[model samples]
Target: MQILITGGTGLIGKQLCKALLAEGHELTVFSRNPASVPAKCGAGVHAIGALGEWHPGKTFDAVINLAGEPIVDARWTARRKQVLWDSRVTLTKELVRHIATAGRKPAVLISGSAVGYYGNRGDTAMYEAADAGEDFAAQLCKAWEDAAHAAEQVGVRVCLLRTGLILSNKGGLLGRMLPAFKLGLGARLGNGKQWMSWVHIDDYVAMVLKLLHDSFASGDQASLALASGPYNMTAPQPATNAEFTAALAKALHRPALFAAPAPLLRLAMGERAGLILEGQKVLPGKMTAAGYRFQYPNLDDALGNLFGR
Candidate 1:
């Protein structure tokens, strides 16, 4: 299989590429800066600029789109919101247009979405069947998935991977939280009751490969791939914020410090604070029922695997 990934230099993309290559699959990393891709990726790499600038000459077996701006890195000013919106929604829309009109459409397009599509649902458990929230994050995912679905018109299969908070030492939330945990300054935010859905970086990549292979077995219908627009790419079990905090601290052999008040987080992070302070109890009902198995289904096991005790 030939898998082409956008944002290959990113944490998830890098690991995904490595795993695919180990499995004897060919790879191409879509990049704005071809030089940004590491030398170690070897001969499988093929750079075609950014998502918006990609030219559709060579059709791939699969195209995994992970191109997007980090949402939590900056304060959510109007400018930041626009950047987030354009990077995911707008860029996805352009890529779909390119694929839909291409001379040779790929077998499958595995585009990245997020559990943020559910919004801040408090303690409510969310499945892919649940209605999407109307906030910025939810709306962003909604638009992004809608755009990716346009590829169905061109006889191309599309899988919307509504990814969760990725648990990796390489980057994402864990990368930011590791230092504080090492210093014993880590604890839950607010009441620590919000449901937090997460996925191991290993299984996350495995699922992408699974979906890519699934599309190969699927034929006779392009829209069949878009049959499930928002598959919850999370573990079977959802943990609370407090559970994650306690497990992380225990694994690191550090004392859990004082809780960061929600008010303080809001003051410091503005609207973006909701990402950490509030969460939806997302379940991977669709993915599991679709024949996918989680490598790390529980928080303690996931934490131990990533930050070994």
Candidate 2:
């Protein structure tokens, strides 16, 4: 299969590309830095600096949309919020436009979203059928998903990935926290009761592969029929912030005796602090129901694997 992927230079995109390549699929990455994509994603990946390059003459069997600015990297000032919105919602809208004009529509669009769509729901378990949240992050995800859904009108199957905190040694949430935990300065945030819905990087890639290959044949009783809808790309079991902290500390043979108060986080991060201080207990309801098995279902096992314990 021929696949066109946006944000192919990102952490998840890079890993997904490697998996797709290993499966003998041809990949073309749409990147802002096309030259860097081959080096970052892998060799043999065709890189395009502009979306315009995907004209009507060009065709792709599938399109993967994962382009987005790092949401929690900086304070959510008015300008920063727009940057986030443009990177995700606006960019997706444009991608859909391209798909609409394509001479041959792709079979499916595996677009990126986030569990943040559920807002800061304390302990309420979120599924694909749950109502969307009204916070900034939630609204952002909602709009992003909505944009991708437009592809349905053009007869393209759309899969919305409501991704969680992806744990990998390369670079992600774990990469940022490893230094602190290794020095034995690991700390829980706020009261540490907020849920942390997460998935191992390997499991995430496998899930994507399943979605890409699963039969989408309509009215075929034998097919998995994973045609279209939102998928919570999280592990079956979720852990509280405190549990995750302890697990990380234990994995690194460190002590977690400190707490970053909510007030301090808010002061330092402003609105962006909500991303850290609040969370949803998102379960991979759709993925598991579709018979997808997780490589790292438990927090301890995932951390231990990453830390080589």
Candidate 3:
């Protein structure tokens, strides 16, 4: 399958490209700059100058949309919020418009969404069929998924990935926390009790490929079923913030941290401090029910794989 990925340079995108290449699948990237394609993505992986240039005449088996701004790095000011929103929702709108205009529709459009769609669901389980929450991130994810779904109106099968925190040593939350923990300065955030849904990079890449190959490549009859809706690419087990901290510290052979006062996080991250202090206990209910298997189903196993515990 010739897959065209929008954010072929991001952490998840890079890993996904490599996995596809290893599986002997063709890859074409829709990026602003062809040269920006990572070295691992290689010569066979040709790239287009922009998503706007996509035409149905050049249809591919699948189009994975992972383009978005980094959510946790910056303060959530009004302007920053707009940037975050535009990167996800606005760009998604543009991508859908391009697909609609293209004469040939890609078999499947696997669009990026997030677990934040459930927004701070303290105790309730979140399913892919569930309604989106009512917060900034929630609203942003809702709008983003809506645009992706518009492709359905144009007769395209679309899949929205309400992904969880991707745990990788290369980047994401685990990367940022590893150094601190290794230096023995690791500590819990707030009460360290917020539920965090996570997926190993291996499982994440596999799920995306499976979704692409199953419904899109076979030219199977499309329905309004989940074949075109949303799915959670998360692990079956979700650990609390404290559990993650302890597992990570153990992986690094360091002492686990004591409790971190919740106020400190709010002071450090401002309104966005909740990004760390609060999170959804998203169960991979949909992924498992869909028959996906996880290489690392537990938090301790995932951490051990990363740090050699």
Best by TM-score: 2
Candidate order by lDDT, decreasing, is 2, 3, 1
Rank the candidate models, highest TM-score first.
2, 3, 1
Worst lDDT window (10 residues) for model 2?
215-224
Weakest ten-residue segment in model 3 by summed lDDT: 217-226
**Model 1 Cα lDDT, one tens digit per residue, 188-304:** 899999988989988888888777777777563543543346678898888899988888899899998779999999999999888898899998886787778788998788888
TM-score of each: 0.93, 0.98, 0.94
RMSD of each: 2.2, 1.2, 1.9
Whole-model alpha-carbon lDDT for candidate 3: 0.82
Model 2 C-alpha RMSD vs. true structure (Å) is 1.2
Error of 1 at 268 (Å): 0.6
Query: How much lDDT does each candidate structure score?
Result: 0.82, 0.92, 0.82
Residue-level lDDT of model 3, residues 91-131, one tens digit each, is: 88888887777766777899999999888888677887778
Worst 10 residues of 1 by lDDT: 220-229
- The regions of model 2 sitting more than 4 angstroms off are 215-224
